[model samples]
Target chain A: MTSPTPAILPERGLADRLTALFWRHPRLLLAVLLTPPLLWLGVVYLGSLFALLLQSFYSIDEFSGVVKEEFTLKTYAELFRAQNLDIIIRTLVMSAAVTIGCALIAFPIAYYAARFARGKWKAVFYLGVMLPLWSSYLVKVYAWKLILAKEGIITWAAEGVGLSMILNAILAIPGIGGNSLSTSPLGTFIVFVYVWLPYMILPMQAALERVPTSMLEASADLGASRAQTFRTVILPLAMPGVIAGSIFTFSLTMGDYIIPQIVGTSARFIGLAVYQLQGTAGNIPLAAAFAVVPIVIMLIYLTIAKRKGAFDAL
Target chain B: MTAAVEFLRVSRHFGPASAPVKAVDGVDLTIAEGSFFAMLGPSGSGKTTCLRLISGFEKPTSGTIRIFGQDVGDIPPNRRNVNTVFQDYALFPHMNVRDNVGYGLMVKGVDRRTRDARAEEMLALVKLEGYGDRKPAQLSGGQRQRVALARALVNEPKVLLLDEPLGALDLKLREAMQDELKALQSRLGITFVFVTHDQGEALSMADSLAVFNEGRIAQIGTPAEVYARPRTRFVADFVGSSNVLPPEVTRAFGGPMKWASLRPEMLRVTAADGVALAGTVTGIRYLGAGSRLSVALNGTEVAALLPAGQPVPEPGATVGLAFDPAALHVMEGEG
Candidate 1:
């Protein structure tokens, strides 16, 4: 081709050359940009997870206090032992309770923020939801530990309100009670729900915000009362958000060790069991197996949510 | 018979109490039973607000609203015997078509079998007989509109409110739905309050219509009366493309020195042969059926519609405009 009068082009520095290269082969540019994060996720995250899974398939030598390099179901069989099984069931029950509690507490706050609060009030809502997350998680757990103590403000307030008898009656209940609120399963549950509430509220608020105002009006126009409209329209439409929020609350509760260790009676949850088994007891295989339980439970939960059409809204 | 819905000087206001935005102001209207009534106006002109007031979605800031002779100002939408087909056709995404249509019945504690049968019947009425298994997401825009109609009609409400139900459809589908809706309204013999900004749809479908402007009813009459003898400059300007002539221009055209409306279709163009209303042709737009000629007369522009194959004047040519005296309808009162 014959050249025309030459037009001046910008000096092809590294940035200019890179831009030209990117324009020529977009896939190559994408690969170059994605390499760092992809390597981090693949090598660091999944690599450690693969190691854990491999360890769960191995057994520890009983007499030598050493991990055997042979793959066997002996470690898996240890999960069915009476003490380990008890810990699993207790943790499952606590996780389910905490998830349900978080959902109930988060829904009204989320709904108010989504549908009613505007401008400054919406800013306040977001600040209130996110403020706790910015504070130290251990600090909040410890604060709860104090508030729920035997001689804390709650007990003093109960006494001031002449409700000590009622409080005593509640503390007399079996299985959930200990010497006081701070050492009870109920206390642990309260802390779990409080800690995870922001997770549930944000996703639920996002879901609720997506629901059109016209839909509610249409339901009411069709002769459905407020309650009916809420049940038939609002709840169903917000299910995907609920499921999304529940994934966080449920999994977080299932794997939390701090709250149970610090607040509740010495009843070992799955997380505490995993912690103690790996560290104090040096039973790494059983700890790995215990860690796998929450992952398996989450997979089952997600599958059920998918089959129920929860993610369709998302 | 009592009016199906009556508004006694109703007004709805929003925003600050110090200086509120009057969405609907001092409006008195009556929708007759068994009539297809249209509320016609541009957006934010209070037509949709009026529909909401009747459906109890919005309460009047002042004045009384009556349904079938009873004052229903305090009543909620669920207690009112009316249903709305939303502009977006807000069908429930999770439910199948049958369940969505049957939701009202289900809320009323009707058995599944009977509500299902009624829903199916309603679906068939809207010509959607066997599409009950699909979710709303699976349906096209037109199909979703049909489902919304069926869902509202399944309740057999005394009053049916449609808020720009056909606004989202294509031209052909909108025309077909217009005919179908008109047929359904007459066959059912129930009051239907439809809201739209489209003048052609209002003229073709409504038994009677109220023309709204600036949060007030400019005029309310049969479609022909509203289209032909509009009571104000606003109505004449909004309802159809009419040349709104000022008092001086009206007098120049031999009118009684009053504000008047001259429809383009009523004006004729001819050579400037010593005609009184002579003007220079500024532009000619070729419409499919006819051509529109814009003529500048005494520095004011007036439009004339000439039928196809009629001789068209070139731009900048002087042309005479002629129209019958009766065609210049005099409007009453300020807009």
Candidate 2:
């Protein structure tokens, strides 16, 4: 047998050689394919993070009103003060509350979508969940402001239905309560829940979709009640999706400033504090340290969630 | 003896009244206690619906269903003493084999120690003793099937419903599982109501099988009775591969019925006459078990299953195909 030249082979080109090379050395090709994105991540994302960390270590010269590039915990010490501590704790509490609330609300909507809603009704339910997300986030936030105002339809309906006393009682509670639904932390929370709800519902539906109908039947066939089936079979399988959604609701609520700035009254949230410190006050070291709070909290969250296999579904 | 499960004119329909799909149309059946019963049918033939009705996953549209001679009309599935092994194996993906197996016990509020011990026993019963800690995803198709069986069997219900549990496995695994299931059912003395579209599996494993066709029972008899003297053309064709002689051939055979059904193996091909019929070989199909020769005669064609070792006759080869005069089973409709 004679060795055939590229011309003699009838199908010869650079593309052919590259294809052959790729087929022979897939790992090398994979590395080559991935390098561009990895380089982009390394330089653009991780590099900026590294720069931010370096800035946190550097301190500002108090007397000269200039940032001095030196390693210090003075900014962190400032961050742990009573006022800063209150903001951090408040943000944590609200995020946790919003996450729990989203879970409680999203589960039924997601369950209805995954299990019962079929054909045209399923499309409608799906559209209802996602339609709010398609509109402008700010528009939705401002819309909530009008809906929750003192003389808004909510208060009017509550009053009209003779539930004004109950609504007032709920609003009169210490931290969360306010004069009206709007112009309060309650308003901010409602808006945050409204905006980030689809994030929770979508992952939950996707997760529930992976659960087989036969498993439910099998559970019933095995003498498990409807409640038992939900607890034993359905809930555990759908946990990763819930956690994936909680990551969105929790992190988004923790880092939000616009909702608070618009609706809240004199409340200094973490995001608002971070914005004021970095953009207005021009305290790079302190602001960098302040910004690290959410990053640190999210890091801890992701690490624990990863350990629980939350990222498996995500 | 009291029936293990009984359905009286059970019917389940779907869609609008104008054009409803009668998934299980007015079928009556009684599953004997401690017998291996199979509901065999093609897809959409309501064998699955029969199994589901037995399991209480679905309620009958109008008819009454009984279990152990008790009217279980209002009883939910959890209230009924029955368990099912789903076709897809339906083992919980999140739970280990032990947890999945022990779930029924756990649901009954049995203590953890007892559940674990029983789960261990069930695992051993299925020959998966050391695989308790493995998730359903980690197991192979055959292993998953056994796990599903073990899980359902762990409950030790009066009746066990299997919806083609071995269908997902390959041929060898399926055959092995079939024997294993038959042995297990006999050993345990539980009423096994298995459903499958595979006629061979039904014929081999079932002590008494119900042949279902289009939301109705075509025939309910022992495998031999159904295979030998099927009452309907559908049953004759479905029980095993049969050569259905057309009306012309039936007329030739001196039958009054519209069609005559005979097993391919019953027909003998020969080079000499003095047999039942003469035909020309038109096609030869080499099945691994045996060769099938397609013979054509007088605008009618029939296939004969010949012995495996013989040289198949060439196309247009003149041959005689013979069968016993009484071997032909005549059918009334759809010749």
TM-scores, in order shown? 0.95, 0.94
- Model 1: lDDT equals 0.92
lDDT (Cα, 0-100) at A239 in candidate 2: 89
Give me the displacement of residue B80 in model 1, in angstroms. 1.6
- State the C-alpha lDDT per candidate: 0.92, 0.87
Considering summed lDDT, which 10 consecutive residues are worst modelled in model 2 chain B?
B326-335
- In candidate 2 the C-alpha lDDT for residue B326 amounts to 81
Candidate that would win on lDDT = 1
Shift of residue B206 alpha carbon in model 2, Å:
0.6
**Candidate 2 clashing pairs?**
none
Error of 1 at A82 (Å): 1.7
Query: Model 2, B1-335: lDDT tens per residue?
Result: 76999989999888887898999999999999999999999999999988988888888888999999999989999988999999998888878889999999999999999999999999999999999999888899999999898899988999999998888899999999999999999999999999999999999999999989989888899999889888787888887878777767787866764677888899888874675678888898888988898888767878899998777788889888777868898875451
